[model samples]
Target: MKEKKQNAVTALLEYAGNYKILTFAGLTLSAISMLCSIVPYVCIWLVARELISVLPDFYKVLNVETYGWIAFGFAVLGIIFYFAGLICTHLAAFRTAENIRKIGMAHIMKAPLGYFDNNASGLIRGRLDSAANDTETLLAHNLADIVGTIVLFAGMVILMFIFDWRMGIACLLSAVISIIAMFSMMGGKNAQLMADYQAAQDRMTKAGTEYVRGIPVVKIFQQTIDSFKTFKKAIEEYSDKAEYYQGKVCRIPQAVNLTFTEGAFIFLVPVVIILVPGALQSGDFIDLVTNFIFYAVFSAIISTALAKIMFASSGIMLASTALKRIDLVMKAPTLKNCHDPQIPKDNSVVFKNVSFTYDGSSLPALSHISFKAEAGQSIALVGPSGGGKTTLASLIPRFWDVDEGCVEVGKVNVKDIDQHVLMKQIAFVFQNTKLFKTSILENVRIANPDASYDDVMRALKAARCEDIIEKLPNGAETILGSEGTYLSGGEQQRIALARAILKDSPIIVLDEASAFADPENEVLIQKALSVLCKNRTVIMIAHRLSTIVNADKIIVLDEGHIVEEGTHQELLDKGGLYHKMWNDYNQAVKWKITSEKEAL
Candidate 1:
């Protein structure tokens, strides 16, 4: 908990560094506000003492014009300070939040790509929300309370000492004891409650995100409201835990303050009357009453400060946890490249004993895998699901670094080439076609945002999306539904193809680009594929073997091992895993066709 507190403080300072001016202003405003807060307390004393001094008989309440005027003047001063502090506090608090958000976003974006993969998107979102909450807590409670409490505590102590040393000593000791008790009790039950609440909130966030993203799948499977039970359970646990801990920590502080306040009054009154009566005179008695009032107000402020710290301690811990999580990602060492490595002179990829493993996994995804693809030459990766084919394809673009050997582009180590230069040479079309929720033209333009209308049209025609576009009233301007739900699977793939064409990169990675197409759509897609693959270094992962039959090489993977490597004709002649799998797949397709014809 101590370490977490330190880390949270560090993170806050680091984030706040960007808006140092704002932070300074906030501190100044808070101090000014605290200074103003003292006015009302002092005014009350002045009014009370003056009323006593002016009254002929203390019991008789008589008109006190000077007292009234003095009180009004003090009240105006108090109001001015109150509002000034409010405005400044808010300004500082909001600016701190804004700075944190900016830095947090930059940190996440600049982090390694693998960071995004290992952690859930929902979890990242949760931390962002947590950071904002933490900042608010720090500004609203920690910042304001600390400033106000110090001023109030100090002022009251001085006033008490001036009035009577005995009362002053008692009050000071009680304040110290209260603060010590608060710190001691705050860690155990208070921290536990906070941890429970944070855990519950994280679970709910994850569940909510899943519910939204998988709503369609859930409805299709007739599992509506699947998250309702979990949500209710989380809320219940959070509420129960909060109430339990709230009673545990807060009640103790309340008891401590009550005991000390009552004890001071009971023990000190008789002592003061005996020891300080001659010194008290009439003025001293008034001082005693006013000093007690000051002590009362000051004690409230001190108790409030302790309470703020107790609650904010949990926030600080959570924020620390979030910052550490974020830092782990942000500080991850991304694969860096040279200043200006030559763009692929030709789209030839060579892997020399390359290997890779996802973090925390014992086994490598691609083990000692080696292969080569020359410019304009096609290579097909064939394997059952989970056979490293996708992993191997990801390496060409340097998504994950090889643990053992190197991957080269145009005979140069990829690590030595600039990332932009390398990415410019490669275009990837994944099995799952992802279309943004925007106009089809804008979606395609993501590949090359500066491409002209003619360029868009040419690419669309090549991908056979022109016909589809012409059918729509808005043509390419038509907005896609969520993840292009408005379009069919085949149409989405065509749009994806159009994006790849717009990229016009020298090397292309096609992972099941046409896997979802119907036969008629597949025929058109195959034509588009031919156009896309023309004069490009292409590595295609084909589920349907027919797509890669004419490729220069077909490499088969079993588990993490490369079981076979050959051309389509050569692999068939060898009659190994590739041949048997190819034969089985062909038979299945034929059987499906026969069954469909029969149904027709």
Candidate 2:
């Protein structure tokens, strides 16, 4: 059996959860309002009939005031019902949008951390938040208008034919043409054009976010907007799509639709003129004039109803595109949790013939890599750029899963361990550090929520942040990135080290932790590393080379493969890649020292 696919409105109702009844109630009320609104026009026809029956004697119309009051009552009733419908739909729309945002965020939260590398936070927020907002229009206004307009058209059809079938058909002809024009713009190949236009909009939004975040770099490079070619191209693409969709795809159809929709009486006028002669011969000229007046007044309602359909159809298309974007966020791959999780016996980390490749890449980042860091031992990964050092470190904490083979912790495969438990066993510090806009005390305590204020202070002290705290107005209580309380690159690194120290995990992974530190801060950060890595199974990626000279084991990697493995002195004795790298490091150091002396 084939399963049925849901349209955008149906899918949105599902998100409304318990509020689905409100949407139904709103639509019903909207339909009733449309029926009520038709009564006023019917009253007009009746009043006209009575007046024509007693021509030239206005005082003989006894029910004119009664019909006027009835019309006024139904008009007021229609407005009340419409407002009540709006209230119901507004509540449902709010709930649906809220649920969509929550569900989208919850789904993406479970995805692997590596997924964020390709998807930016701003882009994700735009997709979920902005797209959810777009759906509100369809739920609240467009849906009610659509239902009301449908009911209005049904009532109009019966009323039009009731007076005279010929006049009814003539009035309906313009509406038929208007509907055809509207569908021509909204359906078929133009529908695909709308989808493409929406896609171009999404690309533009993502590119704009990236451009804003890179403003600092752009200014530092002294570049103009043209320097960001991706952003410029995205803008141009969006503009082209907009112009093509409006000018080429929608222009003729839209013009035709409006022409017929606003001029619904065009066909009715000619039909009434032709019917006048036959009515005169049959002594029914007064009835013809009354019916003509009725149809002429009724034609206004046809224009209103068709306009609603046009706008509602446009809203439907926008909501469908928005739902597609929301689906993209919801469909991101999440890290699979084991049915029966295992606990590690110790902190030992191992990679057994691990081969991993990033998504959308033909080449593997790490291929057939094998190494182990025993409990309480420090293993260093030293390699040139693009040698998979960072990729190897990322695997230990399951930031990304291996494509083949396995990463094991304490002889248990990482995949078998519960995600929370696996995370508690390892603490990773990246080359770049991010600090929240909260107090330093809260930032450090985030690593261990149950940790006391005293515990956070102790961790900060161990990380040698006393110098940083002393200069702040509120010491450790000061908020970072607020009120002029910002830390330098090295200072932020120390704070990150403090977080890891507070976590007190059995395994620590450091990816070039001191890579960006100045000479003074580098010494402080190195001291902090000593305190954090004590008695832990440490996996370190280093580019400075000097930091890992005394490591328990050194693995030198090149081109995703291990080319040499030994202690620093043993590798130097072998006179291979490590030896040449060591010689180069020495020469660089000598050049730095000679240059400084010459400047002095």
Global fold similarity of model 2 (TM-score) = 0.95
Query: 383-500 in candidate 1: lDDT tens per residue?
Result: 9899999888888877777788999988888878778888888998887788888989999999998999889989999998877898776889888884343888888999999999
* Highest-lDDT candidate: 2
Q: lDDT of all predictions, in order shown?
A: 0.73, 0.90
Model 2 Cα lDDT, one tens digit per residue, 469-532:
9999999999887888899999999999999999999999999999999999999999999999
Q: Tell me the RMSD of model 1 versus the true structure.
A: 4.4
- After superposition, candidate 2 runs with Cα above 4 Å error: 1-6, 215-222, 593-600
Which ten-residue region of model 1 has the weakest summed lDDT?
261-270
In model 2, how large is the Cα lDDT of residue 208? 91
Query: All predictions: root-mean-square deviation over Cα?
Result: 4.4, 2.7
